[model samples]
Each structure stands twice: as structure tokens, then as C-alpha cells.
Target chain A: MSAQDILVLAEVNQDAVADITFELLGGARELAGATGGQVVAVLLGHDVAKHAESLSAADRLIVIDDEQLADFSPAPYLAVLESLVGSEGPRAVLAGSTTIGLDVAPMLGAKLNAPVVNACQQVAVEGDLLKITAAICGGKVLAEVEVSASPAVLLILPGSFRPTEETGAATVESRPSPVELHRGAVTFEKMILPAPGDVDITQQDVLVAVGRGIQQEDNMKVAEELAAVLGGELAASRPIIDQGWLPTTRQVGKSGMIVKPKCFIALGVSGAPEHVEGMKDSELIIAVNTDPGAPIFDVADYGVVADLLDVAPALTEAIK
Target chain B: MNIAVVVRQVPDLVEPLEIDASGAALDVDEVEFLINETDDHALEQALLLKESGGGSITVVAIDFGQVDDVLYTAAAKGADRIVKIPYDDDDRPPRPAEAAAMIAEAVKDIDAELVLVGSSAHDELEGVLAPLLALKLELPYLGVIRGVKPGEGGSVTAFKEFPGAAMAQMNVKLPAVLGILAADQPPRYVPVSRIRAAMKSTEFEEKETAAAVPEPNVTVLRMHHPEPSGRAEMLTGSEDEVAARLAEILKEKGVVQ
Candidate 1:
């Protein structure tokens, strides 16, 4: 395949564009510059064309608007994406490593017979090979993968790329999806948006996270009080969320939100890689655990060896 | 509601891993092996599905070495049958594609409506198994599934966790494979009595490895602790002064103007 434009699958939800779409556009801009190619952002979903302004960083925006594409279905989305890639023949396909991208990336890679990389924190064009660095082994290790194949598919991790406010006059064009979506094989029942109270630690600057050490639901008040003092949000480890003390949205781990807060105060967190991977990018990591040998200390910039219940209140008082 | 769960015995996460002197493989002697934590969630989901739907559950353990003990543990947790793929000592490390192939083969004979595997393994291959298995099995696949509810008409609706306050629920056609998220459900602990009974009563039929184990193309050059990050560039002064200093630091760090 010839060296062509870099195709970015711009993700949109409920007529609003996802944040990662611009983050990917940032990376695609860099890649396109290196490859001497244009960045084409592929926008899908009904009424998604109106959000084309967000893709201003791209050189061109390709919109595929369809009523069936309103909701995210693997069959319809993949069908549209596969057709676009086939016809466009872009040098590489970039997407956010979000839920939709994770589901679609590998399948697209398999279909196109190209190499696919997921959760990549960084990407650079190194000569002919696309060098991608992704968190491997539960974020304990960063593996640099070299993809030599053309038309490669990549899923960039959320928050990995800094979406700069670089303005450009991107030309917008509309295209009809070639593949007809069949409702017989798979069907969508409804779209349930998470409640407003959902825990979104990724957007926070500081997070006071509780873990199994908090022990009981009532005891979580200590964490809340500390969070209030720190002006941060209250998050939890998987155990706390699994126990129903916290909603699944509040869980901070590999499967949960990958947070990069300015200050992350992990209370009673054991710092498993799954959890650590989510918070390793934090500017300041302070772990308070009773166990001195807890893995949280490995990544924490400052570690206080004391009971969370005791230390949390003291810290809260100090901050106040 | 027949369910098939894939459990892989991976190097325990707690243990420190060492790359061999050749830098080609991990030192097995230095690492302790346990069921991949994410796969345990898959098994738990399978058990819960079986219990709720009153269907048979089969747990398949795809390992490169001895794993009977792990199989017994899975059985105690509510696996009705276990399929063990016995690998010769000379066999190379199992690739994700090869493991997926073996799993697809094992499920070919069983009338399983859904196959659940971990979203990713802790050791060796990570996050590549379920998709590869889905491709091999020619079934629709979903990854990062936090919760799954068996739906009407041989469909399984899965709640997938997305980044940044987003979730997508998709109803996969029957006989699909789901890569379970670690944050899905807490793993269930089997009673000691049940474990003992499973250890004695459960028998695994060892099947020969079907696919040719692919050689690992990628190699880890060396393993070392990551260089420590973050130096405490503290600023001490009056509240306003401290804020000004912090902002200066942030500006220097390119965080703020």
C-alpha cells in the first residue's frame, strides 16, 4: 500500500463529540506531519456532522451520518469503518482506546490483516516503522512496539495525548456508509446514560481514594471528609465498589478510569498494578497504608506508613 | 444457558519477575504461578450465570505446563467439567493466538452459548486472547465487560465499561465470547470442604495441544525497576506566595501558562 493520509476514527456520543477524539487528532497531527500526509478524521453517527468543528485540527473531516449509526453497534460501526479504510487506504488508522475502540480496533485489524496496538500512551514515526509505547503487564512495564505494516490500526489510551487548541481550516465532506447494517443479527435495546452522580475521577485534579482498608461502608466517611478538605473527589479500589459501598464508576483500576490527577491520595490501597496503572501518571502520588510493604509505595512519590483512618483525619485537619 | 469459561494459569502478579540471561523469556523459577486474576472474574461470572440460569458450566484451563491443581480450584468454584490442554516440557510458551485456537477447539464439541475469558492475562500475552478466540471461534466478541445478563432469545447483553464516564450495552448474538473485566465481579471463594471434594471427585481429561505454538517474536531486553519519578519541588511561603510559586512551577512544567 502507498503512504497515504492517516485516518482517525473520531468518536461521538449523543451528538456530542468524545474528548478522546481531539486527543487522537493531536497525535494524528504529529504522525501526519512526520509522514508528510494529511490527517482525516472519520466522524460517524446521526447528527454527528455538526460536531465537525471539534475536528478542526485535522486537515479533512469525513462524515458518515446515518440513523442506524446513531447508536454504537459493532456490526454497523465496523462495517462503516472497514469500508472507509478499504476505499481511503490510509497509511494508518488511529482511534481512542476507549470501550468502542477497544472492541473495534482488533476486529478491524484482523479484517484488514494489519497489526493493531492498544492502550498506547505514545506514538512516533521512526523511519518506516511506527513506534508505539503501550502500558504492558498491567502498567508495570511500558513496551515499545514497532509496527512496520502499512495501514496499521492503533488505539491511543485516554489522556495520553494532550489535546492542544491548535486551530486549522479543516475541509468537511460527507460520505454515505457503503455497508448496510442488518438488525437481524444484533439488536440494540436502549442507551442508558450513567447517572450524573457517577464517579469520574479522571476529570479531577485531586482524588482521595479508599480501598479495602477502609473496611466498612460507614468508615468511608473518613475518606469523604478528607476529600472534602482536600477539595478532591472520593474514589475507591475494586473491593470497595464490588462490596456495593461505592458505585462501579468510582472504582479506580485498569478496567476503571485511568486517572492522572495532580495529587492522588490512595488510602488503604495496596497498589496492585491494575490500580497503579490507572494512577501512575499522577503528578503527586501519596499512599497511606498500614502495611509498610504495600506495593502502593513502589509508585507513590510520598508514602505515609500509618493507618489510613488515623492518617487521613490528620491530613484532612492539616489541609483544612 | 450452557457457559464455557477460559481460565489461564499466569505468573502471580505479587511475585517479582526476572528475565532470563538470554533476555528471551521470563525466569519461571523466580515467578510463582496462579490463575490470572481477570480470568478468575470470568469464572465467577460463569458460575453466577450457571447458578442463575440452571445450566451446565465447563471451565477450560489452557496451560503450557502442569495445571491440575488450578483446574480443581476452578471446579470447586462451580465448574462442572474441566478441559486441560497438556503441553510437553519441550513446547514453547503458548502464544495468545495458539491459546485461543486451543480454546476454540475445546468449545467446538460443547454446546456452550457463551464463552467467557479474562480481558487480559497478567503474564505473557495480555488483552489479546479473547479477540483472537472470538476470531477463531467465528463468534461475536466483546471486551472489558463489567457485567453480563443473559437475555431472551439466546442473546447475552453485556455492560462494557468505557473511559471518561461512558458505557455501552450491546446484546451479542448467542454463542459469543466475552473478555471479562477485572472490575466486573469479585471472585468467589470456594469452601475448603468443596475444594477438597473437587480435588478428589473432579477428573480432567488431558487433551494434546492442537496448534503449533508460535515462537515469541518480541523479546524483553532487560528487566529493572523503573527510575523513580517526581522530585518534591516544594514552595513554602504565605498562602498567596505559595500559590504564586506553585503556578510558576506549573508554568515551568508546561502544565499552565
Candidate 2:
């Protein structure tokens, strides 16, 4: 417990550590180098200590094992974090900007009176200042910021850093909950997994994704035709699925599936950062939209500034 | 049950955004403000909860952009009270922590059972308000909630989403903050006539709080548009010409017959 340590909060999924945990560990290692601090990983949950064997990227692993942490409840988690962050004044605390991070980071910042930078993509310590680049406005803009406060709480976006390849062992330290864990106002009931037996968009080589420009449910047929003609599966952005025009399994974005198809055909998609996070790794991307300034064009391999309604039918006919 | 819903306006992304002279913010004069999409969902969820569970909806907002019109629309959609905090600083709103503190001062006396805010806003994707405000109010917090149903014994069954489409049914007790991702139903469309009526009939409750501008924890060194990767080969010309070009490229990639 020292100021010369960088702390990382490891997120758990189905009793195992999530990939974002390792990504944060990797990011923490870089910051640790700049601050000349040891990388410490904080794991909280029941029986989660077994998963700590894979987190060797950190210099030390602190496991707060408790039955109350069997599932994520914000109050207990926040309480435990306040104790830890207060005891060990780390140079910075890093967490993934996912559900858990977004839920707890701000509260933790308020509790500790520390600065918190969200959607953080890059962190650099220049001279005596800690600088960060955060993606705001749905990835439409990037802002470079400097944090003048000590022990900054940084919520890092997933996929921003590569997972560490180092495989050394970490010093494991087991500790009990600092505060008495009580059943608070929040209780975790059960997990709801997406239904199976749908066309898995993640496995498909070619995907035709539609967005809000599809407009109505009836217009989905045009995108489906384009998908069929391309020998591909039909996927959609969040808006289409939110309208219940497609199953949740067919949705792509930060909250939905992360896909890497060989050929991605985006129709009328404005390409918000969340949606772009899913398909940016596709081998080739073709975007069709009426707006020439749509962010989709920035990531597309081929961009067509035209109405997708017209382009869809014409592409279906042209392919046939 | 008494519910407090927070709504704010963000820059409409339909048009391109320009950088300001300061190089650290957007050119707000050239931007148009629209009610954040998720905040609209938050308002809708509040309205739905009120409709089903029997409650009063109080819509609160920071005075920025054309928020008066948004408050009127909420009134037309069944909000019982409207509270507007007077703020006329730069176009950029307060940071989440300061904003949360400011809002906490306004709503702390309401003694509401639930505080619903959008999970994230287009202008500020961090979605920190709910949790920060929860910390201030000493309440539990949940974010990325898709649907919320009033549960037995002063709790609500919140359908909260994890990453990768996984969801969980959480029993969040009353006096909690929920960052709503979407409502069970789409936001209702109030007729223009109804809005005009609301404008004429509705009175706003003003809350005066000390707007001490704290030094920003995070100082923006620069703000700029994301640089295009330049990998995109824009297919220009008429729609037919682009479609033909796309087909040939798809064929070359061996992705189509």
C-alpha cells in the first residue's frame, strides 16, 4: 500500500476474469513505467482468487474475496474500493469503461475527491504532468487533457490497449473486506443470456448491417435482400435492434456483439463510436449513406455517398 | 413513488462539428442542440413508470441550449413538475462531478424514490451523473439499464445490460439512481398543440444554487476531429456507378458469386 503503485480493478465474468481486465493490466503497466510504480491488480468476488494466476502483468495482486461479492452490487463494491483507494494512495487507478467502470468510477471519484477521466484512450506522463487523450462526442472528437491531481481515477475504454504478453507470476495477497458487507438496496437476480440458434454474425464472413436510415421495419427487407445477394448474413446497428426489427443477437456495437467479418456492408449507418468499435476490424468495409460527412466513411474501405435505399437494390441487381 | 428525471441537450451530430478558436472545445455557435437521445429515453422511462406504478414525475435540467422547450415537452408528456437550474456559462456544460453536485443540491429535498438519468449523452459519453449523484445522495446506482419494472417491497427489477448483450435482472431498492439505456416503449409524440398548451399552462420551479466554477480536474490541451485513416476508397459518381463498382470489388474479394 503505497503511492508508488498503479492499481487496476479486474472485472470478472462467469467466475473468470474478463479480457478487459488484462487490457487494463497492460495499460497499467505502461503508466507504471512512467510513474516508476509497481502495477497492482485488485480482484473482488467470491472464489475469484483462482483466476489471479493469469494476471501476471501486475507486480502484485490483491484479492478481496467475499461471499457478498458473488455478483456485482454497486454499494458493496464502492465501499470496498473506497477503503482500498484510501489506504493505498496509488499514482492512478485504471478500470475499463464498461458497465462496471461507468457505474463505480464516478462514485469512487466523488468519494475520494479524486479526478476521474472517462473514455480514456491514451495516457502519457510528460515531464511532471499526466496527460490523457479521451474520445468524447461518440468518437467524433478526441480531446487531449492533463490531470493535475494526484491518484487520478482513469476509466479506460476497452480495445484501447493490447493485452500484455508477459507471463511472469504475481505476488498474491489475500485480504478480507475492509467494511462489513451487507445486502444493500441493490441485489443481483440472474443473468439473461442471448438466445441461441440465430445466424451468428460474428462467424459470418460477409455481413450487411443496417442502421436508423432503414427507417421503418418494412425497409429491412431491402437490407436483407442485399445480404442474401451477397451470400451473407443480416446484422444491424443498435437502433434497428432497439426498435425490435431484429433480434438482439443480430445487433452490433459496444453493448452487443463485436464482429470481424471479411466484408462488412454498412447501409445508412452513421457509424457512432460504439458501432465502429464492433466492426472496425473487418477485412473490408463498404458504407452507403446519403451524408458525405458520416463517421462511417472514416473507417470504410469503400464509401458511397448516396441513398442506401437506392444503393441496396442496385447492388443486389448488379451482383445478380 | 416520486421520480426525478434529468434531461439535457447535446450537439446534434447530423451536421459536422467545427473546432473553436480555443482549440479545446467545439464551436458552439455553429452547432445545434438536440435533446440527447438516451435522455429522451430516460424521460420516456420516467413517464412509463409513472403511468404504470402511480407516481409523479419531476423533470430537472440545467439551463442550457433550448432546454425550456424540452421541459415543456416533458410537461406535455405528463411530468408533474419542472425544475430548471440557472446556468449561463460557456456553451460547454459543467463537468460531471460539478454538474452532479449542482443537481444534487436541487433534488436532495425531493425525497424521491428513484432518480433516472440517461446512461450516456452524445456530448459526454462517460455517463457519470447517475453514480456521482448517487454517491452524493448516498444511494445505490445502476447503469446501462434497458427496462425497469417496479418490484415488490420497495424495490425495482432493473434489466441492466452488461457488455456483449448480456443482461441481468437486478433488484434495486428504492431511492436509487438508474442510468437508463432505453425505455420499454419509445418516447411518445406529443402534438404541437399540446406543447403549446403546456407552454402556456406549465410553471417552472426555480432552484438557486451556488455555481462556484471549480478548476477543472482535467484540462483539455486540445480538441480535434478524429483523423480519417485514409483507408477508404470513396466510390463517387451516380448511385448506379458506385453500385457497379462495389459489385466488382466484392467479386474480387471472393465474398460473392
Candidate 3:
């Protein structure tokens, strides 16, 4: 009814903002530019105002700060977001397709009876229609979807949108969450961290990953050496993790972490869709597999048909 | 406790999917199909919960014609009943909404205190079915559930894996739907004897197909292997020479300082 306001739902954990939040803001900026709309970032957390300036790119920043909202509970988070969406009637709501966003986006969409496009790679607004593209069937195909519903909720793939440092003197407003904080039906459990060195790979600019072709667990040192040379993190295919050669957090595939590094070098990795989809957004992909026909080459920017044992050490030495 | 599990026979993960000449759909003829890996996890969780709670387990699948053996395999894995919704030859590939609708309708009659589904289907529809099914069933849905326990008063509590070093426990009222993540647990192997007996003894009741599957609006324009960037120039001579040559290559590729 009113002028379309773009709502960007900010996902926070333990009083820290998620990286994808800024990425979604980048995308919202582009969408707002095209549609003549204002970007309004909705943040819910305890002391949320402390992080308001970081999101100054938004035309308007709405903060719902409550002590009960310190941790991420779907009841409080979803209720606040739902209330904001209802009151503002944003033309579209965008969120990062992370684990938190994935949980909250759909719930918000279902509550509003709106359609949601999840894990979209690209979005374009033409007049009133919004066209979103996402990798489908793993990374073998790309599907372009058009959403016609009003106040559409979209889960955008992280790293797909590059965050720009163009800050504006935007206004920030603090508001009370209309939703009451009911004792959640869910309880808080202990958090289990991934094994040491199995930290966030999505934030890294360069990644060196290994696959089953490396032959044995001990032999993974060659790939690790290469990663060290590149100043990058070590990642792996599913089989590597399944074999216990690498931790599950280092696994790069549909089930594991999805990374969009600046450069991704795969050693002895076949390009399975599950694995490829996770890294397809990497700016430059160099896959070194003995098998020339390995699927990894399908989407790789560069391919080398050679054994990783020879190629990996050589590359590492050369880089050194 | 009564648990319902939804499974689908999808193209084997190890085998590559081939696109048909039309480029519109996968060439199923070349690829072998199996129970989706995540779906297997869901079935295993259901069986585990059933064993723990002393309950019955019903496994439901939308048979898309090529994967009848997968449905029987579910029975071998410990499903008490299997319902197959036959695929309409004329209809398009079953979408998440359609499968969820069929599963919701079938489970309506069955008294299921909990419904479990694979977090994501291996096919194009990954992680879409469970949430859609939860909406259709009007049940609170939990995604990426790694562990489940029977809480007090006929309620189920699950530890869901969240991003960035976080885990959330959701206590759902009875008759809730859960989507099990693929990494939740390893699927148990069924003995050969059980497999053979399941193949012969499993009885499938087919449900009426829904309306003509809507034709997909978007179509793949073409499918082809990506063109290789360039050949790696082999470097020979001393390590110093090799390093120098490699640095030059990286500079040429704009990868180095």
C-alpha cells in the first residue's frame, strides 16, 4: 500500500552480527536502487543499538532490543520479524540463507502466507516483479524463479552478493517488538564446537580442498602443505570427512559448509554436484584430478589432469 | 509413540546424473536410483525412536515409477507399512508441495505422534519438502534435528544444529513433523536376508494421483561441460627457476602480488 520498503532481517548470535547480514544489505541496496524503495534493516537482539551504526547503509534501521532476545530463539526472533513485516508491509524481505535464516525465513513466509525463494544467487527487480536465480540439481543447473506475491520472503545465498563500503548518513530508530516473549517451548542445550581447525571456511578468501583421490589419510599432508603455501584453509569432499581424514566442518558439499572463496584449488577432487554446489561461487576454481573427465572440471575455471601427489607438492613448492 | 517417515528414491549420489537431449530433465535411464541419503537418515531415526519408545513406524514414498525397489528397501530397514503414490506418466516430476500434500493426506488417518522427513531430498527439491509438509500439516517443524528425546507429557524435544557454533533444542507438542539433516547419523545396513524377505513380502498400496503436474515454467536452455581455462605450463629446472616461473604464471593469472 505505502511506498515499498525493503526489509533486511539481521541474524545475530551471542551479540555479534553475522557476515551474511552485510551481504544481504549489499543486495538490498541494489534492489532498492532499481525499485525506488528504501532499505530498512530489522535487527533483534539485546543491546541491538550498539550494532546499529554498522548497518547505516540502510535507509532506516529498526532495532528491537530486549534482554530476552539475547540468544536466538525462534519464538522471539520470528515473532519480532513477523510483527515488523506486518506493520511495515515491505515489498520484499531478504535474509541470508544460513542455518538461522533458513529456519526463520520460511516460518515468517508461512506466517504471512507468502512464497519464499531460498538460497537465491541473483535477484533482479523489474517494475513490480522480482526474478531470482538459484543453483538447482546441485550445481549442474541454474533455475530462474519469478515471484509475484507481495511482501515476498527470500533467503539469499551468502557470498553471492559482494558487500560494498558505500555508507550513507542513514537514520536509525529503536522500536519495541510488538510480540511478547513467551517462554519458548524449546530449551537451550549445550553447544558443540567443531573439532580444532574446523572453523568457518566461508569467510576465507582462498581455500585448498582435498578429495578421496588423495588415496590415504596420511597423504592429506600434501594438500595441507599447499593450503599453507596459499595462506588458505584446508577443506575436503564428503568422502574425506567420512573417512575421518578431515573433520565434518572442513567438508565442502551440499551437507557441509558452502564457501565462496576468491580462489579454490581442489586436489584430487571429483566435481560432484554436492561438492561443486558448495564452491561454485568461488571466483576462480582450479581442480587437479587425475581423471580428465571428473565433474569438478565442469564448473572449474581451470582444470589440470594430473595426480595430486605430484601436482600438489609441486604447486606448494612453486608457491613457496 | 507412533512415528511416520517420508522417503524418496533419488538418483544415486555416487553416479553422475545425465541430462536428456531435451535438457529439460535428468536422463534417468543412465543413473541408478536409491533412497536419498538424508531420507535414509530420517528412516533410521524413525526406527531408532520406534525402538526406544515401543511404537509403530510407517514409511511413505511417492513412487516416481523407476524406484519401486527403494520403497521395499524401507520395509527391510524396519518400516511397518509402505504407501506408494504412483507417478502420473503425464505429470511432471513430483515437486515438494505435491509430495508433502500426499504424505500429509496419507498420515492423516494414521495416528502419528511424530513425523520425520529427510532435511532435503537429493533431487532438485532439497530441504523443501519438510517445511512445506509442516505448513500443510499445521505442525511445528524442526529442521536439522541431530538428536531427539521423548520429553515429559507426550512431548518430543530435539537438538537442532544451527549455524556458527550453536545448537537449539525445540520441544514440540505431540504430532510434530521433523526434517532430519543428512549428517545427523549414519544409516544402518539391513542384513541380506531381511532385504530378500522385504522384496518378496512388502505390499504397497498406491494412492490416487493428484491433478496434472504443472509444467515447469523455466527450462534449461542448454547443458554442456564448462570449457577449460588453459593448460598449466610445466616448469623444469632448479627449484628457484620453477618458483620464478610459477610466480610469473600467478602474476599472469592475476593471483599473486
Candidate 4:
């Protein structure tokens, strides 16, 4: 039963365990309950131990406080995790589907000769089996997959599982660095900040965000009229920003600005998790897309199945 | 130095996508296939590295719909060598793990010093391919990189994206993998005339790796629309009617008077 325990690598962003870490910890609790195993959190950072008290989802927390491991260089993190896996032999290793998770999960899986079930939106146990639900073809095709039985590594997408409010009285254990301090091959350089854009879309109460389905830059005028009529700010998904159709500040999603607008209307946005993460919390969401299977519709409070080309200007005229 | 870039072919999901009969996968027979918005960044990154540092660039992929066109396009963009694994188009398309194993087996013979791939492919949800491929190759991989440059002593410095417009720079040792979110710049545009010229002259090296294609550890049991079912109240009718319907809802929500 100890072999089946789950080890979670808590991710730290800006000196704190990220929201995704809390989300994954919540998922880990459910998984541990299914396997009758304990959940352990690996806390590695300059002052990461402070998070130990807040990580109530874990049955135990292993704190490896070291300044040398402060920055995210894959080699050192891998070294620590490999050593932990060696000693703990947990059957399942869970990581947040962040940059760190994408960087580390596969490498660790390769090192352990184990298979990885990546980007699981949902996890369920059918009898003794673990099924990871993932999406492909831009979230149109949903796949329910089973990882290797004995042990599996999973990268769970953010916003898929709700963070639980459960609490635990887990004791913390401090361990010395198992690997030498001579710094791994990868060395951290300075952090480069994004340029400040013209307008901050986060401050707006209502947002009208567009994606590739808008088809061309010229059509942006139609979306503009809608935004203007509704007195909402204009925002876009990444492609629009990448194509220079809009300023970076007006972009919404993981790599862009996160907006919790009171009312968000998504036009032609297919709702990739990255984009969804930014606007999913809008008090009211209305998504218009031609593709019924588009992932954006999954999260929308009100969904419209129609071509944006037909609907955009029409909605603007009606609103006027 | 030898460098390899993993090129992938995927359906332009932005266009209409249809599900297959068994509901197993996308209906490839009906949809148009193209290399959508990935890997070419890796190609550009490889070219940039080759230009500044000395290296031969190789493009690698498994046979998917229109992969030859993608490899040929890579050739047009300045890949020195192109290799593709010939596998069944009917068998379930290779998942990230299986693709990595197949690519690793084929790449073993090429002996690349560094491998660069797009940060994430649209088809490879949550960006799994590069890290998975790097693992099978047993190489250290850096993901979500915006920029990369050759460093002293066979190491490279890569800039990875952080939220709130922050970028982290790291000096990673060579024989490594880099997931290119953006190259030094967007992929250099190879003109249509040059690509057609490349198509005629290029020699694609295709290897039969059906046996090397490992069975997918993860099997897709079923596919269906997402639920919290019937949540959206569809507003249908003529344009005027639909607009009136939407406006009424907005008024109810207090977004407008």
C-alpha cells in the first residue's frame, strides 16, 4: 500500500505555491483516497516551507529548503525528484500542468522507465484502474486513457479540478540535498518582464474577446462596434496579439492578461485551456462559435452555435 | 555540430473538423491536412543556431497526413537533412509517448547534438511531445522558450516565458532539447516559388519503423462533447431575431439597459 502512495511536486511561482499547485493537491487527495495511499508534497525553494502549513491536502510534506535550488533549472530539480522516487517508490507522481510540469514530467518518466499520462483534465478510478481524461484536436476529441498500472506520472491542467477546502495536520520533515551543490549544467539568468502595453484589460467590467474565428484583421471592426455598443473593453486571444491585431495588454489567457470581467463575451474563441484559464471566472460568460465541440462552449454560461461572421455585426446592430 | 528539429503534421482544427465513424479520431479523410502553427519555430531556431554556430540541421517526424509536405517545407526553410518514419496512417495516430519512442529510435542513428521542437503543437494537447521525446532520448529539455543562443563550452542560453510579461533566462548544457515558443523571430518566410523548387530537388529520407512504433500506453477509450450538458440556451432564427434574443438576455444579466 505504501508503494501506491502519490508524490506531488508542488510548483512555486513568485515565492509561493501556485494556484495550480493547490488545484493539483486537491486532485491528489482524491487519487490517494482511491488507492488507499497517502499524499506527499515535495517543497523545494528558498522559503518554501512556509507553504507547508497551507498545503492541507497532503498527508505529509517533505521540505528541501536550499537557496541553490531557488531558480528553476531542470537538472537540479530532476536530481532531487529522482532521489525521492528512489526512496519513496510512490506508484504515482503528480505535477501541476505548468511550465515546470511540462519540463520535468517526461524527463522523470524517462529516468524511471515509467510512462506518463499527460494533461489530464479529469482522473477517475474504474475498479483498480486509473483513467486520465485528455483532449486533442483543439479539445474537440476527448480521450480517456489508462496509464501504466504499477506507477504513473500525470500532468494535470489548471482549472480542470476544483481546489478543495479540506485540511490536514501533517508534520513536516526537513531533508538535506541528496545531490551535490556544484550547480547543474543549466544556470539561471535574469528574469525579463513583458513590455507595458497601452491599456490594461483587467480593469474592465465587461470584455469582448475574439479569437482566430474572427477570420481576418479587417473584421476586427465588427467586434469593435460590439465592444463599443456594450461599453465593454476589447480583448483578444493569443493569435490576435501574435498577429499584431491587438496590443499585448488586450490579450487574455495564460501568457496574456487574466481577466475576471463581470460579463465576458467570447467571439470565435475555441476555448483552449490557456485562454479559458483567463476568462473562465467571468460572472457571466457567453461564447459564440460554429463548432459545437469547441472546448470554449464547455465552460460558457450561454453558448451560441453560429458563424461569428454572421453573428458579430448582427449582435452589434441589435445592441445599438 | 548536428542538430535535429521534430516536425509534425496536424489537421487545421480551426477549419471544420469532423469525427470518424468509430468515433475513434478526427475524420482525416474529410478534412484538409496542414501543419498548423508549430515546429516551424523549432526549424527557425535550428536555422538560427546553425547560422551563428556551425551545425547541420535535420528534420524528423512520423508519417502523418501530409508529413512529406511539412518535411519539404522544412527543407525550403533551410533544413539540411529530413528524416521521416513510415508507419500506418490507419493505426491510431501516435500519441506523444509513442511518437517520442518512435522518434528516439529513428534519431538514435542520426546522432544529433541538439534537438529543437515547437513549444507545443495544436494536436499535442498541453504540449507533451517535446519533453516526452527528450525523455525517450534521455536529454535535458527546456520548454516554453522564446529565445535561444549558443553559449561557451557547448551550452545554450534559453529564455522561457513567465506570466506577467516576465522571461527567465537559463544556461543549459548541450545534447539538450529546447521547446521553442518563439524563435529569435517568427519563422522566416520561404516564398512559394522557393518551396516548389525545393519540392522538386529535395530527397526525403523515409525509414520504415513500424516495429519500432510502440503500442500506446494510453488508449483512447471514448470521445464525446463536453458536458454540464445543455447549458447554453441556443438563440436561433433570422439575424434580427437572434440579435433580439441575445439583447434580451443581456438586459436580464444587467449588462445593458
Among all candidates shown, the one with the greatest DockQ: 2
Cα lDDT of model 1 by residue, B1-257, tens digit: 88888887676544565665655456666666777767888888888788778898888876654466778888888788898876555223576666777778888777788889887664432237777788778887778777788788888788776554356777878878888875345787788888899988998876665664443333333433334353323233443444344334434544333
CAPRI quality of model 1: acceptable
Writing each residue's lDDT as its tens digit, candidate 2 over A1-320 gives 66767899999876667878989888888888887889999999998878888987789999999999989988889999999999988988898888888888877877787888888889888755789898887677888988777788898877788888887688999999988999888899999888787877899999999998887889889999998887899998877776668877888886789999999999999888778878999999999988777789988989988888999999998999
Taking the candidates in order, what DockQ does each have? 0.25, 0.70, 0.25, 0.53
The list of candidate 1 runs beyond 4 A from truth reads: A1-4, A195-207, A211-233, A238-245, A252-263, A268-285, A289-301, A305-320, B88-93, B122-127, B164-166, B182-185, B212-225, B232-257
Error of 3 at A216 (Å): 10
Mark the 10 consecutive residues where model 4 chain B has the least summed lDDT: B210-219
- lDDT leaderboard ranking: 2, 4, 1, 3
For model 3 the TM-score comes to 0.78
- Measured by lDDT, the strongest candidate is 2
Across residues A1-320, which tens digit of lDDT does each residue of candidate 3 receive?
Answer: 23477889887755677777888889989988888889989898877798887888888988988877876655577778888898899888998766567667776876776667665778889777887776554444455667667788887766668884768766888877787876555445456556566568988888999987898878989988878877788999865764556666787865477789888888888776557757887887777777665768777766666677877787777777
Which sequence of candidate numbers ranks them by TM-score, best first? 2, 4, 1, 3
Better of 2 and 4 by TM-score: 2
Docking class of 2: medium
